[model samples]
Target: MKIFTPIIINGLAVKNRTVMAPMCMYSAQEDGFVSQFHRVHYPTRAYGGIGLIIQEATAIEPRGRITDHDLGIWSDEHGLGLKELVSMVHMAGGKMAIQLAHAGRKSRNTFEPIVSSCNQRFNDKYDIPKQLSISEIKDIVAAFKQGAKRAKEAGYDGIEIHGAHGYLINQFLSPFTNKRDDEYGGSLEKRTRFLLEILTAVREVWRGPLWVRLSADEYIEQGHRLEDTLKVIDLIKHLIDAVNVSSGGISPSVPKVFPGYQLAFSAAIREKGLLTFGGGLINSIEEAEQALAKEKADLIYFGRPLLLRPFIVLEAAKTYAPELVIPQYERG
Candidate 1:
């Protein structure tokens, strides 16, 4: 099946098409350091035989955290634990990617005033964020570059920039969240400026399989849709390896979702000449194969299923790759 086949991105040859999507565990310490929970939680998926496992959203700065518990890469000290985490995952036979993120208006962990493309509040529940100044935006761009350096130091196989789910980058890309009239907002090109800067900055420090997770659709009328993202991809495909296609989170409106609801977006984006990581509620290997077969996505990621069954890959290899012998008695 295409699901078990190797695929190359840039120069990185992943052993299979299956990936454990980056899902926030929110289990880090108050200082945003890796905890025992992360040590055990991640490697289990590696032991399960996943080809690539992208770690959850890790903050680039203190105020950038979504919550106090979010993992961070804003400092070198954070690199020590992350390097060990990568070693553990590799020992268990999996490649690791780290998602560098900043929570924007959605941040609830910082005492400093929250900031975003515009002075907006996600809702009354989140703090009212102040609009970012030109210089401050440049500083945040530098922060992402610094975060990529830390990921490289941590021995991560890849780096994924969290440009999705109404985060800082998303806030700028979407029309609904970004109300500024300046260079960082308004027209699509201007709105894409911040993300372009971040990507450019990150590339200066790291030379691995780089990815950007994008909310292809905001699920709101005034927001960006798949077409908008395709345009964005055309501009940045030269700088990154893949696009992790996802939707929603720019607004409070809850979208009607279903299994494989996002595959079409990924397929569309892939058609636009770039690799994509696509999955939305897809739990079956058959579904994974169908997506890969149809060229809907270059890779398939399982989020909740991996949480419940970390051994899904091992279970799959029994049927698809009988030559393997991890669970010796059961496999043979």
Candidate 2:
């Protein structure tokens, strides 16, 4: 019942709080066009009763893709497929957002040189990225602005900046990866400059609800901690609408995970007078309801669960909010 309630963020109304967390399908073509799989994939969840479906990491540039299969918004041509995707979700009675992202040194595109805040490799298996020059950094920042313009043209109801999972923004924010002594790195304030610039650039075009995903715990002894993340939030909290919280991503090795594992991270960030999205390994609707009921997180995000059970929201809605169970409704 709690999850079925409508709420507004930045003047945009979502039907419920059960968010379909952005999970990469890696199903795009090499050219990064939305494939037949994506056409059916997201709208299925929308029809299944997902409140807000955040499309997986969409690359801002070809070289920024985590893999060649990642969907792209680097050019205007990508908008046609995205607009069709949004139309499908709207027809199914759900709202959707897109996560604009860049891979930095983690990029596996191979043809183009990988880049990062410093000349570093996440690990030996990946290329040791060339340290980004000042001009290159500005170019990437402008790319994000352009991505926002494309997302708006495609009719996304909201935008969630992918600043998590050791991606480009995370690399710049972390002391472990950003060894730059320039204005983009050094003190915490300087370390946050890159993300701030991206946020400012995105705001120039996107007026919809804006959310940002953050890797709350870097999971290494000297890597970023929740304290560091809170400080970063302090700098950009006013720039975005909510922080989608997750953890243990700076390291390639998976950290220990348990039900409600990441809720504490979101709780700590919410204490700073900011809204947050929280869920990791949460298995049941009951646990999700509890998270919202207790106000541990404002939004409950389902990732693996949704993959395993795409119609889970529809099933839950049958008991929780039967009015939304319109499986036969005309959806075209």
Candidate 3:
């Protein structure tokens, strides 16, 4: 059987198992508006035969942006430009999704980043983010909702809350960054309360497909573990439609491998009966097929490979299932 088979999430139908992973292009204008670069950069992959295309990590609030150059959906102005990008993907015959994110302690304000809790000398360049007051936390939640709303209005098929990579959401979910004592801190349940709250609120605004990107484990001790993710998945099984499995932080340096090194995590989520997307080192047709045959993941995501080969999915489909035909333009 081919790995590229139809899978359904909520009401959205993914045409194949191959997904185009969200990558940071940092090509947005200073005002956080999508440019021609964002439009042409994304839709072409879908045209090349990707089943799903996730927009880059978009900051929910101004302070939440990793770089001033990162994409944002905090306001309607952003939605205006994003509408064009989303439309391009759909017109190319692919499903589109957005990754709503906030860079908590990880804010790359080389100009002035913000931290959620206390400073640990990691704030030489980026401004130390003040510990969010009860009120500030509420505002942040609202920002997620606003971001979700904009994504929907912009015509995206779904939204993926970016809770991995030690960003704002991940910081609170992991034990290493969040040090609060209020309802938002201490104990795994309390630490997890923040992510659930955001998910609950975003769910209210976005009625379509809902997905979450989670770090299976930060790959660090005292940080989030597979058990932590499983616990959250248990709670989210009802609210979420799918879970995208990923790991590492903004600064990642892992040993190089062929592809599908992280399939085990997706398999864990799959055990829960919730649809899962496997990312990280996913590169060839054979690897993609093995992921499905072994039940490691339901969907496979491609990242860096898209930049090197725009029509990789089409090529892979031909290799894995030679009976499939390729368009004349895609052959070259």
Write the residue-wise lDDT of candidate 2 on 113-174 in tens digits: 89999988999889989999999999999999999999999999999999999988999998
Per-residue lDDT of candidate 3, residues 1-332 (tens digit): 45667888889998888888888888999857898898898888887888899989998887778888999888889999999988898888789999999887777745554757444323455556778777888888989988988898899998999988778888787777777888988887888787888889988988799989998877767677788889878876778888999986723434344467778888998899888999787777677778888889888898998988988877766666544434555454
Residue-level lDDT tens digits of model 1 in 26-130: 899888999999999999999888889999999999999888899988889999999999999999878999999999999998556788988879998988898
Each candidate structure's TM-score, on Cα atoms with residue i matched to residue i, is 0.97, 0.97, 0.93
On the 0 to 100 scale, the lDDT of residue 236 in model 1 is: 84
Lowest lDDT sum, 10 consecutive residues, model 2, at: 323-332
lDDT of 2 at 46: 91
Number of backbone-clashing residue pairs for each candidate, in the order shown: 0, 0, 6
The better-scoring model by lDDT among 2 and 3 is 2
For each candidate in the order shown, give its overall lDDT on alpha carbons.
Answer: 0.90, 0.90, 0.81
